[model samples]
Target: MRITAENFIKHLKKNREEALQYVIDEYIGIVKAIIYNALKSYNDPQIIEECISDTFLGAYENAKQFKGDKEDFRKWICTIAKYKAITKQRKLSKAPFFYEIDETGNAVKSAEDEYLIKSSTEELLMMMSQLEQLDRDIFTMKYFLNMKNEEIAEHCGLTKAAINNRLYRGKKRLQQIHLGGSMS
Candidate 1:
């Protein structure tokens, strides 16, 4: 039977197993597509899975909000996935581990910790535009795409360990140029 939002909601309201499965089957790909696009620069597999789970959880919790419209449902779920991706991206970007290192070798205020992170987002983008193609690809896959290391390895034809190494080195280089003196 064709799944309509009205029918889906009816079954959902009843808490029927078929209703839940139908929702999953119909919308999981949509959620994944939204998340994958938003996180195309990221390479952590779990983040994608987390976003996917959160997408469904949001849908389930907000089932009552699902108007009997397919487009509306897709938009609602995609919105949730986008928000989740942005939140996750902000959290990753603000990691203290990537904070600036002082001449004394101590971690100073984080490169990502200041108001500039929010304000200088465009600058960050500009810097990314300056990276080599391969570096940009790995960086995008790791941070933007949010794929797993294994997934990136398969996509890029490298070992997971090699992907990790490249990501590590590439990020370090970005930090050095962007967060180091004169850039931030």
Candidate 2:
């Protein structure tokens, strides 16, 4: 019996290895993209790759609980990838740092410096969460991913001017929140 999209869920529930392979073949790109986007600051390819694997493993293990069709499965896998990457990020932040020597023989990023950077990033993300979903996504793409306004516009299906306007307003809102003012 061959596995098709229509029967994917049924096969997955049976714990068929082919079903897992089918999912990997079909959705690896989406999984990797979500993991990479979530872990962009890590600068460690190995960790990102590990998170991708973990996401697949999670989906396979949790297959019985999944409902809905192929489109839902794509969303489910993406959600798994996102949470796995976040878990990896949190674990990395809590782990101790080892000093690495640069070409000039100077150590890069003291433990304290790393902690400060991680904490500040967490704070920024918390503030970003207070934004409307679209504004939050635009802010993340523009600032965290370092994507250009044109690219963000294209990705978001908005005009560059709209992207600019949203960014401006989002910044103002963040500033107000930072200054102990409530979001209006």
Candidate 3:
């Protein structure tokens, strides 16, 4: 049978196993990208894979609630993926040994904490703006892209030493900006 969002939803709700294959084929890429954007910083493939599975499982479990409209599939799955990713991120952010039991009682951060993280990210991006373009690019690749120095060096056709120098100087400059010191 042809797969439509309506048909897919019906099969899923009815617990027809083959419907999963259709959903995976149709939606896995978008689901994965959403998860990746959320979990990029952690760099854990296992966590990423688990979140993707959870997202699908969530859709299956909630299939009855969905109207089974194909037009709504993308948005619905995206919402599920976003929440699943956030949940996984919160779980990974809390380290068992880092905090006392009482302090770690709530692993999930409040919405305000999420806002602060966003603000901090914006501030850091703004700080990076003070550096020369090459310095900024190098810094982003190393930190945001989480590329190894050797990988970045190869990409930029520079030596590993060059990458390190730019990172050090860029950091110092950003620090100076933050400290309100005269640029050296």
Reference-based lDDT, each prediction:
0.66, 0.76, 0.72
Lowest summed lDDT across 10 adjacent residues in model 2 is found at 117-126
Best candidate, lDDT = 2
The model with the greater lDDT, 1 or 2, is 2
Question: What lDDT does model 3 reach?
Answer: 0.72
Per-residue C-alpha lDDT of model 2 across residues 23-60, encoded as one tens digit per residue:
99899998898888888888889888888888888788
Clashing pairs in 2: none
Query: Candidate 3's error at 17, in angstroms?
Result: 1.1
lDDT per residue for candidate 1 within 1-184, as digits (tens), equals 5556668877775666677778888888877887877777888788888878866765676565444356545545555566567766776666556666677875466454554643454345446545655666666666655678899899888899988888887777778778653332
Model 1 CA lDDT for position 128:
52
Clashes of each: 18, 0, 0
The alpha-carbon deviation from the true structure for residue 132 of candidate 1, after best TM-score superposition, in angstroms, is 45
- What residue pairs clash in candidate 3, if any at all? none
Displacement of residue 104 (Cα, Å) in model 2 is 23
What are the per-model C-alpha RMSD values against the true structure? Answer: 14.2, 8.7, 12.6
lDDT of 3 by residue, 123-159 (tens): 5545655677577667756764458999999988999
Model 1 earns a TM-score of: 0.47
Model 2 scores a TM of 0.53
**What overall lDDT, based on C-alpha atoms, would model 2 receive against the true structure?**
0.76
